[model samples]
Target: MTTQTQTAVIDQLSKHRTVRFFKDEPVSDDVVHTILNAARQSPTSSNRQTYSIMVVRNPETKKKLAVLAGNQKHVETCPVFFAFCADLSRLDVACEMHGEKHVKGLESTLVSTVDAALVGMSVNTAVESLGMGAVMIGGMRNHPKQVAELLGFPNGVYVVFGMCIGWPEWDKVPNVKPRLDESVIIHHEQYNTSSPVPQIEAYNQTMADYYGKERNLHESAWSGPLANQLKSPRRENLRSELESLGFVFK
Candidate 1:
């Protein structure tokens, strides 16, 4: 690619932000097709492509999903919503077609989940490149059973997450949030976990300032909320839920 093209790509990536507010407009079918095509090009585990994307456009369905997804308004308001599923059902059929027995367990679940995540990120990047905006809604997992039933998902299929896509309300678009310093996350060859406290402190202050100024919320540090979250079990029923959906993460 030319330097200009590379720079354009970098600029587009750097400007990514979660857009909660959207314009009262619909995305063109051509654009949707292009975005999904990009997602299809993403790499998958063992070339199995163990994932599925469901596009939801009906208002009533969106409303119901919004409620299920912790009442996120973007789920209801976005012109398009995608439910990305980690699906093993297709793999089962493929194995049967080839006269091979399908054996699914922890490894299979991990592969499918990774495949779904990779495609989801690819779709997000594609949306951003097209000057559209999106937000991933992990809250969809909060009530996986209900979400699955609502979408008529069969056993061996489950929603990994949802994405809301639309033309962002430019005036209300948020700035790109800060991430942890690379030093804290990236290690040189050997693993280095000597101490990340300082890095965490710095990042927390940076995030606190950003939230206070940009989001009009007061927070002393990011670690506090994260620590609080770790103090208790979250989604304790996820294991049973996954088992019910034909996943044996053993």
Candidate 2:
């Protein structure tokens, strides 16, 4: 790709936003597989690469699963949807074949999580590069067991998140949402907070202005909304849900 192409790609990435609704067009199996192929090429922990993606094409299943993910309706309407799992089951099988009960301990759970996240991001980036759009459904964590049952996931595997993918829908196409300034989010050798204060303040104002115009909403600062989200606790039983779905966060 030329410099102009690269610049356009980056600009598209910068403009990318989570699409909540999608058109009725279907994504072909070839395209879905290609997207997953990109995910398979993502970097993983020590190249252990413990992750699996379950593409959900069944409408009934998607509908039921949508309720689990905060009742997000896009799960059903999106052309293609996928559930990325942090899979240790294959390692468990490998260990069993080696006559070991658990060669990879619970500590390795982190690696699988990292692998899954990496692959998910890889698929997202690839999709964006292709001019498609997607939104990651982290709310899948809110119903681990339900999701596992819906997907018929095996033991030693847990869904890290779900993703909705499709061509951009008209009304759902989004404007660029600003991000934090570099100084606020990036840190050098030692984590520096003092220097980020001004940058954060500036970013908050900038994003506030953007939201006010685009959303026709008030110019509220970032911290307030973030704090509000943090203050509203997640489902108290989420840990138990993970445990039931075979992830013992020990």
Candidate 3:
């Protein structure tokens, strides 16, 4: 019962993957404008649009950003890089203009973060539809303070993540990775976790097989590495860093 529009959208989404290697070609300003315009159409919390996208094209800036993002070469090589930021500074100005006291707290932080994520994902989808590829750089959070300083982010603004976009190397394109089974992820009208372990175990086997064939890696299960990763705190200084950026999570 799928319509043409639904099928087309689903096909595009199904083929998505993190494209790291790209060709050394420039993306035109017209394409960039179209992609960003698509991103701007994403929904925002309370219609506040508490987000900003920093398009980085300068070679030196991209080089420094690559270093800040754990020396990811793609950041430096991509024709277009974008820093998606959660921004409350504009909201503060709006409140001032309306003669209302600005509220800065955990709720505001969450809202802005969600807004930025929506825009970022929308941009990703738009780019992919246009036959371009992109990869998100969560490593931007490794040194949030430095990234903020380099980007000249003001108080009440912080980077959610970075994205590198360009034409992907066709030979280096990766397989469409498998995901968790719908039975475990989707619940009908309620939260159901009954017998989730078996579902996870099955998915682990599927992923392990995929990795063995695609990556030539030996792994018992996908969950093992992921579980180990959660044993330690990631970005231990992130809270203090966020506080310094004027996000009081009170």
Best by TM-score: 3
* Tens digits of lDDT, candidate 3, 140-222: 88888998999998888889999999999977876998999999888999999598899888999898888888877758568
Off by over 4 Å in 3: 1-6
**Number of the candidate with higher lDDT, 1 or 3:** 3
What lDDT is reached at residue 79 by model 2?
75
Between candidates 1 and 2, name the one with more favorable lDDT.
1
lDDT of 1 at 159: 90
Query: What is the lDDT of every predicted structure here?
Result: 0.90, 0.81, 0.91
Q: Model 2: runs farther than 4 Å from truth?
A: 1-12, 103-106
TM-score for each model: 0.94, 0.90, 0.96
* Residue lDDT tens for model 1, 56-113: 9999999999999989999999999999999999888888999997899999999999
Instruction: List clashing residue pairs in candidate 3.
Output: none
Candidate 3 lDDT for residue 185: 86
Question: Residue 6's C-alpha lDDT in candidate 2?
Answer: 57
Single out the weakest 10-residue window by summed lDDT for candidate 3.
1-10
Could you arrange the candidates by lDDT from highest to lowest?
3, 1, 2
Q: Which is the better candidate, 2 or 3, if ranked by TM-score?
A: 3
